[model samples]
Target: MSGTSEGPTPATDLSRPSVTQSDTTMCPSTEPAATAVARQAVAAAPPAPPRSGPGGPLPAAALTPMAQSAPTPVGFTGLAQRPPAAVPEPPLPEPPFRSAFSAAPLAMAVVDRDGLVVSANDTFGTLFGGGPEEFAGQPAADLVDLTSDARTRHAYHEVLRGGRARLRCARRLKHPDGHGLWVQITVAPLAPESPDVLLSVADISARRELQSRLRHLRNHDPVTRLPNRTLFFERLSAALEAESYERGGSGRIGLCYLDLDGFKAVNDTLGHRTGDRLLAAVAERLTRCADEAGHGRTSAPLVARLGGDEFALLVEDSTGTEQLAELAESVLTALQAPFEISGRRLSVSASIGVVERHAAGTSATALMQAADTTLYWAKADGKARWTLFDPERNARRMTRQALVSSLRAAVERGEFALEYQPLVGMDDGRLRGVEALVRWRHPQFGTLTPNRFIALAEEDGSIVPLGRWILATACRQARRWQLDHPDEPPIFVSVNVAVRQVWDSDLVADVAEVLAETGLAPHLLQLELTESAVMGSAGRPLQALRALSDMGVHIAIDDFGTGYSNLAYLSRLPVSALKLDGSFVRGFQHEERGGTAGRPSPADEVIVEAMVQLAHRLGLTVTAECVETCDQASRLRRIGCDTGQGWLYSRPVSPDRISELLGDRC
Candidate 1:
């Protein structure tokens, strides 16, 4: 082996010891060798035959034959002897460090200052292409394929130049026999300030394989075995980043976010295991759809299970909205078929939101949000279909979101107002009552009517507080009207109530409190609900209505004949009036109708007359809505409708206008 010293040569094996006439320094010192030789010389000299002269015993070989066989009575030297002395052998010099380096458990090699392999051990050569000598003069960096990338190449050069303390990196290497392995390469200075470094290679194939398996498990869904939400988000971010950096790319991306309709009922009725199988089946179908969608594209789409029954397909470099729509339509068609789970066939449908756009300024979060919103629109438009993202629709949804977030606050800020429409007696033309309607005086969009925001309120449960506010404000106005018109019959105030108000809030308590607070008689305060909200209402809602009725408040079914009329239900309730739906009135006036220019059809008249006669038999008054002309009012009067409402009487007006109308009626 070569040797290094403080002299001329800069390279040598740091394991072997050597000596020369001019240079005595070596990797291992010579003291142990000299000591070993001295110990050997001392052990080689024979001990003098155990003291045969004087009082010491004679040698066994010199003893007479008779003396050896018989015991000597005085000396007792007849074979009475101690065991032989153990030889004091010299300690073995340590097997050479060169031997240890050559037989190292791990593959090892030494590199010269030029970054070329000075020598490689047997293990190192075995890991490389050939024997130890074959690796001589070869570049260490190329041996491990470290030059494949510029970053790692630069780092290796830094280690060779002794500028870096150490270089530890992992590499994937393929052997000459066609097998592959993952190896960790460690390079560091052989000694302090030594340019020549030792390179150690450790095979870590098993560890790398284990890590890869664990990563796959962590990133995939257990139920469907599809990439999970974490992987989806990662891919989405990566796609966006890649698009941002590449100029030749498609520059557009799209996604289909879908949710299986009525999946909860399946999960609730069937077991989660069955639901899991269904999800897996759905994932398989979605993957096939993605593959089909990407037939002509450079890369296929990614299908991932977001959670539960929701899944997403990501398309990088998408062409446009049309392509995304086609993909969504295909997915809808695919999922429409029955999914057989646990030997029972289950039919399911999916609502998908399709969104596609240029990727230049879009972020993963923004894209996903757009997809989610579009999916909701798909469900809202109708389930079992797909809806492409429309900017106008998105803006409307954003407006709705803003309203929802601010709804409760708006009530506190007093952003709502009430208007009253008078209900007049059809026969006498006297004011019977006023129906209170709500309007939102928005700061950005002025004066939004109930048609715009009532449903939104009902959905988010903000209607509870808002409804309470309407009841209190309307009752106060009616009480003021009574105070102003004491000489005349006190007209009741009718307030429209949402069914949610009955379920979510204490309706009986709210109405009773308002009536007591405003000093209004319960009979003079009327609470109106849609026929749909009134019919089949039991449990809490029914109890609330009955309690309110027992408090002497009138309970009128609004928009009568629009829903399940359930005439049988009316006879059992404390209902006071039925306001015919405006649709029935519109039937008499529409230009496309079969009726004469401005006359009600006999069938329409008969429907109205029968409804009025039935209500009269049930001891309930009837109010006809949407009476825009005197002829409609006269016709309703002939039908025996007790009260009339709509444009003919008055459009819903301010409290002052209603007061003036009441004064006029008096």
Candidate 2:
């Protein structure tokens, strides 16, 4: 049913071909005209447009080869042969190597093992005012300024030898401009595969400026621009340690700690700003001392501000005490000059304490403490001076300090007791009165005399309480004695009063209260005062003395001639008796023998006679102290002295002993 209509036949029914089963061994029949037409179409077409522009185009002969290559299949006689398998193309090789040197932020360059510049980055070329072409294959060191130190070259070599992977060096680099630029160069090994070294340079001018500022702050005082305490101590410790190791421990370190005596006044009068300027001037003078002391020596003692008006100096390896003394003297001389501050010239002096100690056992704290203590001593001994450390004085000071600490509780603990020494009638050999003396029966120190602790008591202001206790105790004892010995003439009990007791307390009220409480008549309770102590009385002291005297309390001047002998004023005073100084009476035995074994000298007799005459004329009785011998006593009696007190009568005795003496007299 392959009929074709006139209009191109019915398309679906144009051709129908079938093959019977069991035809697997046979080829399918194909139209020979269709296969010939396809071959002719391919072979007859002009060759495809040329792939690339050429001088000539493909010929018709080339098309004949393409037609012969097509195989004719037996079954269809039109199938084309499949092409052979295509081969894979090899991967393209990596691009040629380029240096990373040109991309580094820092000026970078690659140097060969021999320190030759194999390549350089843009930064490096720009730094040296040359392009990479000019620097490549050139010696890297050639661009470095010749005046650059050898240390930089050595560091570079160290990095190149692989001794260090990276090195930092400061070097001067030549620039196109006249001046060279300071740079810090860092060199590092580039890669394991190459012997090239990578160098990185950065201009460090700003960093160097910051470093200089830091160094200045470290070594100088912020207030005065002088060396500070830290630097001074550092230098001192080093010097001392050096000397100790060098001399095998013979050398000494001397230090002087000085404080301006009246600097606080200056600061208060002027402003602190002016004080600061004055301090600067003082520092200059002190530094000059250090310089002069060092002379040509490389190392010198450091003078430093320890803060405020205080300063310190470290003297190393002093020759001896003489050298230290000289240094102290120099300091005094230096500080004597006036300082001009804020247009005013102010005069100031210094009190310096010097301590010299060997480095063997001396520590910084110990040395500083010694100097501080000595400085206080100088201030106390009177300002504008210097004092040297003395171990003996320090020992005594410690003892006094211990005593002071124990004194306030002494009276309350019943550690204090009173002893009495009788003042005898020189002519009658009769008891006239007794002087009350305070003693301390310390549990640890045994018995302490008045001389030992009285000064300490006065210094610490404890004497007022202690003195009150003495007055009360003495008055009570005197009343008791009067009660027991009614047959004997009534004897007065005289208690010594300290200046502090008079000044710091109402001594008159204390004495009146004691007399009233004990029922001891005022006439029997006499108060003894040193002449200087009485003279030192102010308004209250004079009032206290007058009130006591008005109460019938006999006031006697003790140690009369040794102090200010204002007898004219004494007459106006309420004092009833003048006790001649012990020193004058002890010489009495020398008078008759023209210098007997223990006799008063003729001059002593004259003085004693004159004192008695004067006292008599003033309606005052005279008592000679320290009448130790019968001859001395006899001489005093002959001189018209009314009373005598000494070992001749009896040494100061305890209450029990006094009871026994009074009992015997009765």
Candidate 3:
């Protein structure tokens, strides 16, 4: 071999050390040109025997019969170098196919078309708890539990047949030690022309467990383990969009909104810990009820806690209202049994609102709102019951709410106006006074009577502000009329007061301010409270009425005899007059077959006479309400009623029209 061909660059190859250059004994540093030439010449010659003495070839006896096949290196042998020889290049061998497969980190195996393992890496053996030799000829399906999954089997066959370039799947595998393992498995054709398939596996058990835990926490309540509100609404929204087979149509859904009656009291009396336990117990019972209701059905009912003591169930394919009603009833029945929590058996009842409808146009929010409103009805109608949604009632309630919102702004915007109905003197046939009927000039609904929104105002406590507005407006208008018509007797303006106004507002203060501001006499500004409200008054409300009465404000008990008539209270109250309810006044005439007027009903005549006599005895005036005809007016006059206010004098007319009536009568 020539010196350059057989040089240490290839034969020794020690210039680039595998370790640090400090460890030069195993691999030496590079040499100068002269030393390199000498080392190259020495390496090109045949191998010498192991040296016994310094620098020379081994003694002849030491070389005995052993020929070296390959050259060896000597450090500083100090022998004279021979001439450089020419060297021939050795033939190159083919690359081994199994080198990369044996060295890969992830478990890898080569399998035949039959899924029998031909060769596998040490990593595959270690991962599966076996050696490559032990896995050889063994069906790879046995190790991967292929019988448990058909898709995996198909994928395995496809890759082995070169039908697919590669395939991947996640599955649980059976280990040799009898435990199951989760792994991501990949299969691919071993080569373009090979009959064997290559398989790769990665351990992913931890990742899968983490994902499962995250999902569980997301969907379930931490305390009760029931689905939370997020999942509940998700499921409900899905149900609302789901198709139904019944009635040969689609879009049907039902929901039962549940609230535990007096649950707050329990939480207040018991600590939150006990309350938590109670909630858990309720959850279990509610879940049971849902499962029972959904038995044998493809779409089962989903029960979930919607925070606090409220829960709801989604009936995916509800048959009808009757089915929903039964489910609600079942919930109430289930809760009837006392729950044993913290060694105490506590009895509780739930109110449920049931709503079932075709889901075509109904949204989840609308459905939930309807259910919540109906739940209030169930509670209001006396608890421990379930209420089915009534569209008519809901519309009425929504209208009332809309009115409430508008009424608040109405006061601010001064959208209200007053109309007056004349109260005629029964004996004198003169206009004595007029009731100030509040009207709403609604931007949308036109003129609305007090009957439409008065009760709504009272319920929402908006009546306080609205009532003050009414009083001030009525007084100002009455003062204006009195100023305009100096020739006429000063007519009073009677303003109705609600029960809530009596309790919630400073009625005496409001009335006194209005009188002071309008310069109207208190006696001419009559405050009419329903009999039920006056009779029920006590404490602050009673004191308020008494204070107003002392200020010379005429206080009339309107709608008398319809409420609980406390005869004793009638004398004690600071009442000026009794306005008989229209129901009593309507009975006065029995229409005869002929057009001719008939006599008053004797029963009504006696009742009216008795009421008038009692009022006179109490030193209070009596006004007969609803006198619609001449016969009715004549009878009211004969009964000694001081005044009669009805359609006979006028239906409620605007202040301008009342001015026209006063011009004629006063």
Candidate 4:
């Protein structure tokens, strides 16, 4: 204990605060005694009396002399009532959250439940050019691109209503600088218990531009700036697919495959640069035509450049063949004009193949192939024209291809057989010789004649081998007949030779080999060629014929006078006979009364007489083909025709049948 200095205490200053041990009474019982006693307390004479006021509560420290004049809560709890301890006024918000939000790169904003902007970060102000002061109290709808429309507003509502945790989209926002800002927007509720939403925006303008450029490069031709082959095919495929699914309408599609005529010549004459410019001009014109044709429709036709001089047009929902024909005609008319490039006028024409078909049954690839084939047909019919795809014609061509493929094997398979048509003496009415007609014993078509497969063979160059087979087979049969009947007049056999065979094959060598193999006399084997074939013969072809004639092989010109005949030039070659065309013989008997009806046509008789007289002067034998009636034979004989062959004598019988006829002397 220390000595108590009982100095008279200085008069307590009521104006100043005083400390006393009784300050411990202000602490709650829950506090430790030492904590309660250690608290530095202000002079508290009796706890402030409870105050009455409309306001709720006031702390003892807040009940100041100046505050007493204000309206007091009726149920105010004073110091004696022990007011609920202060809430420790939630520790001042962490600086990091405010700092991070303010420093964020993405535009961010806080929107209240009423759709008003509560707060915005620095990034938001910088991005939108509106500071927090300007943004405050402004409707959130005006700030973000969303909420401007019902669709976006609904999306915002979805995220706010907990239907979605977050929402994202591309939005176009108005910029402060009067330019549009493309942004990828993301939005989310700040908390489940809170009405505020956090909206974040990221600029995506550069990305969109890159994507657009990539798409352009993919779909367009760099030089012509027209849709390329890839885009064309894709459009065609899509059109086909759509047509297949459509109901009750004509789902027909039309395609025009065009190739610029004489384009290569232009490229060679004027440099590639000029060619490229020309191609670009052509593409523009083609695009114009497509647009004009497709005007007033929902979708325009697609025009594209395949490569070089080739271009294609896709017509979706075509009307029919007539409409396709009109389109093709319009394209042709458009191209008729000359293009002036680099101070020179260049003219070009296009061959178009138009193919129209029901979309349901066709594929894109098949349609394009058919178009290509028809385009070739246009070229074949003469360029600068358009050809429609003909299924019947295509079938014929396909059959020809099948035959050409089978022709090489036909010889090895022994599918070929020969028939003999009789040639009778005009005066004696006896068989003098027989023309060998080749027939094909096809497995599918059953007995195809020369007319059906002959052209195909010539086209594929199979005629050379086929012609050799015919010559060899005919010579063998003729030799057999001569050996069988040594006493009878020696009969001859004639084989038709194609122009391709004459030019492509060693005709003289082939005939010589056949004759030597069969031991047939040259005079006994007569080779026949069409007048046009022999008339056009010259150079190697003429030399081939002369060589055959020199080998003692009889040469005859069939279907005489039908071709441009060169009698002056004919005298130089070795031609044995002139067989009058069957057409002239058919003219002799027109339908008249019952029996051998009309009199022989005067014009035909005059022609036959003139030809016979001319042939005799040339020292060439004259034979009349197709002596079907007595009138024809009598007319032919009166005109001094040496021999006649037709159905009147025989209908191309087999070798056995011919031998039987010989034995019977018919």
Candidate 5:
């Protein structure tokens, strides 16, 4: 029966006897021996009484009553009901995983799955004026008053959603100190765990200040502190775009490109610092003019420093050409006033080229090119003025530039040659000398006279080299002529010397070298200088002329009486002869008529003869120039003129023709 039945064991058997401390007793029972044994052990042990002392340990039964009472299973509601001790935990053994947020050098914080500040580093705590404990449970967004732009917020959301690896935003953080600080916040999401985000913030005030300074340097000229070319072009492009959108309905744009005349001389004479100060002053004046010009207009012109000694203005919505012209005139007038720079009052003038165009297909490059070309025209027309663009004039100007470019190689390529016009002795009909004249044999254009290119050469300063070549060529030809016709009277060769050549180089040395190379007598070579050129001579010119005069090289004043005539100074000069201007010689015809036909008008032959006699008395020989007719030549001869040069004898002819004439005359 015991083997087959499943029934409870007897109470007596279960109540087993007590054993010694070392011995263990076991109870036998039908209701699982383990349960019966547990009950017996609990009944046999005595429960501790409650402690009365303040520091005494709790009684075992009270301390673990639940553990002993029903033997509650582990890991269930009963075990969980017991409160944990209040002792501090060991900081949860710092987490093994490193937070991306904590790795940031700047202030950084981590927002956990609930958008709460789960963790913050020391830097983040200090940045917010709080500790990690204070910030831990707070909403992350609430810690930062993130009232940022919508775009910035969207970027932040993108980082939070793990759509972007990182997001940067410039935000204003409300600091504990009443003032808000600008910070650049970068947010990045943690890997594997999408719910967490890392935020890094940096103060950007100093960086922003640096960026502002860089922007200023980019837009403003370093020297004048005015808008530079970059800014000017930016403004111009904006104006053009605005005008284009307007479609010429009412608005117009005008550009004025001005270059200061004689500014190079100022830079060369004064120091560069002084030149810089002058440029600054010029910019100021231009700014003022632009302001005054745009008083009632839609927009004032924007003035800018384009480059060295150059400035520009952009006039917007001008009424008409008259308005633009008036503005340019005003600029000119404003610059006429003397500028006081570095304690020196210096005067300057500008040549302005202005172009006014409606909102059309005109481009900035085209407009600026037109203005630049027109400015050159203004300068060419004697500077300190303004010129408006004309298509025809611009076309001609292009041709002229092409010509100037071609002219540089003209001398070397044998395209240039000289011709001689005979100067006849007035007393006798014999040829005394010849004036060397330059001619250009252009490939396309026919032969050009000296008047056509001499000025160009002078302007380009090619006259220095061209004039030297002319002197050497003329001397060589003269020497050849003398050798061929030894019986003919010695004839002088007069070479026109340019003022620039006189001032820019050793004129006396050049003349001496040419004479020596050609084996021509010093007296046989005459240098003709314009009266104005002579009068404007400084110390170098005077010294040059004196040196030549000492070497027996004759100096003749060409185009006399046409310049600022100073007879007293002329007497003091080391000049040997005067070439009467064509105007006075042509007047001789009128003089002869006046004497024979009327009661001798003031311009009579008698007055002319008297002037000639006076010139002779002063030991000055007079040569009549441009005596076109034989009658004028005869009159000049009778008036005691030494020589006469005109088309009546011969136009300027080439060396071969001159040689033929020498043969015929001899």
Candidate 6:
């Protein structure tokens, strides 16, 4: 009530908005008859009772505390504070979920908040037997045997109390029927006022069995029925890891990696089926050998087949190198016995590489690498034997490998230089031409002769670039020599060429480029090759030599008579000269009368004479190599040899020395 005088009712007061009987009676004459009826009904009905909390009924004063304690204030009008809004009713549970769950096809159970089973479905009861009611009061984790592990049991309990939203795990269990079963269990929290969990179980036995079979097939070799490379590496890695974290053990590992020698020939001759049978037999023998080696040890060595014609026996916690050596010897002896395959008797031999060392610092990769290197050593040493690893020998091989890796770089960096050996006229004892010999000036090993790295270069195709460099460098030097001694005959320079250079690169193009660049005549350059390199080769080498000879480049057969001296083919080739091998000249160095040097045996003289006569008849000059004395030169002169190259003139010398020789002869 407002503090107005005498409390007269105000018709425009907004504080009292309800329609009274007087106001309704004085309503406009045009008002609708329905509105009048609603007003009368509202005025007739009483107001709603005050809302209350769950504990008890609440009064109007209790809802607005200021209204309960304060006196009325004039012109200060407002609504009292409102009570809080009522909470909404929860959604209705869909359908008859219990009936559907009870008869559901899936095996399921309900777990209470305490982790005990509240109920189970018909399918679950049938799966593990003993009806649905019997599952009650049992721990839910016990249904899938999760209680065996405390961690999983604790996680299950956490899921039941709603701490975790869901959980899934699998286990292998023995059923009441005495059969093993793999079960996948899933726990999901249910939505209810009283919190609970829904547990599901699935039989995964078939899937588990399939996975096991797949693992077996993947880890074993089909041909030999032994562990394959993948499994071997796996086991080796595990062993290394275990040894790295050793606990009072030997911390040692050993391996015997073997390869069947000439196994490819067997496969080619008898067919792969026979090869497979032979391999299987060999695996059995190796297994037996490994078992024998394992006597009085913790376990037998693991026998595995890595790939084609390769097998390994891995020993963990090896006693010493003697154990690995014994195992290798046993393998060699076992594989010696002949095997009958495809109605053919096959005798095979294995080369075994034995390596034993402390495993604490080694890895699978390093061990396998060492074993592979040692296996190569065994094969190179000779088949049908086992060789233990030696660090010094390995270091030498490692050095060779380093040299191979650095060869191309060395060539590019100009680490090679040429030395010229004078080839003299045998009759007049004058310099005819100089042979260009190449040497490697290694930074580490000082100067190295061609014999050290030439073969390696040839094997890896590095010889092509090296040969190109040699040709260019020698042609340039020869041109310079001609410039230095304008009065001399402009002596020719002979350079040795490896056979691989012809096929592996554009030799004719390289030589033409070099001659064009250096402004040197093609006739001033001679290319020498071993007899084996030129005698029997036809295709590319033939074409290259013919093309070069047509270009005025001389092709001489070097180290003659040491190889297939098919003298008949000599006339067909583009050869210009033949250099007799040093072996023949060394015969002249042999003593006869104990005190005085004598002529070579008649056999040597006749061979030289015959070779010289044949060459002269074929229109090719003959050069005698390794002549150290005037008697040898006179003998070669009598044999009709056109030129002689040996220490008699001088050892291989620098370009300056060649210039000095040319200066004197001029």
Separately for all candidates shown, the number of backbone clashes (residues 3 or more apart, or on different chains) is: 0, 9, 6, 5, 1, 0
Candidate models: Cα lDDT each: 0.77, 0.71, 0.75, 0.74, 0.71, 0.77
Stronger candidate by lDDT (3 vs 6): 6
* Per-residue lDDT of model 4, residues 248-273, tens digit only: 45688889899999999998999999
lDDT of 1 by residue, 46-149 (tens): 22233223234433222111212322122111122222335433323322344556666678776766787756668888887688767766788888876766
Residue pairs with backbone overlap in model 6: none
> Which of the two candidates, 2 or 3, achieves a greater lDDT against the reference?
3
Query: What is candidate 3's lDDT per residue for 17-123, written digit by digit as tens?
Result: 11111111111122223322232222323433333322333332121111223333323433222333355233222122234445556677767788877556678
Q: Give me candidate 2's TM-score against the actual structure.
A: 0.65
lDDT per residue for candidate 5 within 374-452, as digits (tens), equals 8988999999999998889887667667667877788778788889998888776777899999888888767888777
lDDT of 4: 0.74
TM match of model 6 to true structure: 0.69
Residue-by-residue lDDT tens digits, candidate 6, 603-623: 777888899999999999999
Output the better candidate (4/6) by TM-score. 4
TM-score of 3: 0.69
TM-score to true structure, per model: 0.74, 0.65, 0.69, 0.70, 0.56, 0.69
Report how far residue 607 has shifted in candidate 1, in Å. Answer: 3.1
| TM-score-better candidate, 2 vs 5 | 2
* Cα lDDT of model 2 by residue, 1-666, tens digit: 011221111111112211111111112122123222323222222223222112233232222223223222222233333233255233222111222234444576657778876555577778888775567656776665311445556656766786654454455444687665566554555533335566556776566556667866886798778777777777766765655548544477888899998899888989888888888898888888888877876456668888888898877776566767787788899988888888898888999998887766777777888899999999999989999999999988887788899999997888999999988787777777889999999987789999999999999998988999999999999998888888877789999998778778988778878888999999998888899988666677788889999999988899988888877777678788899999887655554654455444688778889989999998899999998878777777888999989897899988667766763431
Task: Name the lDDT of candidate 5.
Answer: 0.71
Q: What lDDT does candidate 4 reach at residue 234?
A: 85
With candidate 5 superimposed using the best TM-score fit, by how many Å does residue 616's alpha carbon deviate from the native? 3.8
* Residue 542 error, candidate 4, Å: 4.5
Query: Model 4 Cα displacement at 313 (Å)?
Result: 3.0
**Model 4 residue 512 distance off true place after TM-score fit, in angstroms:** 3.0
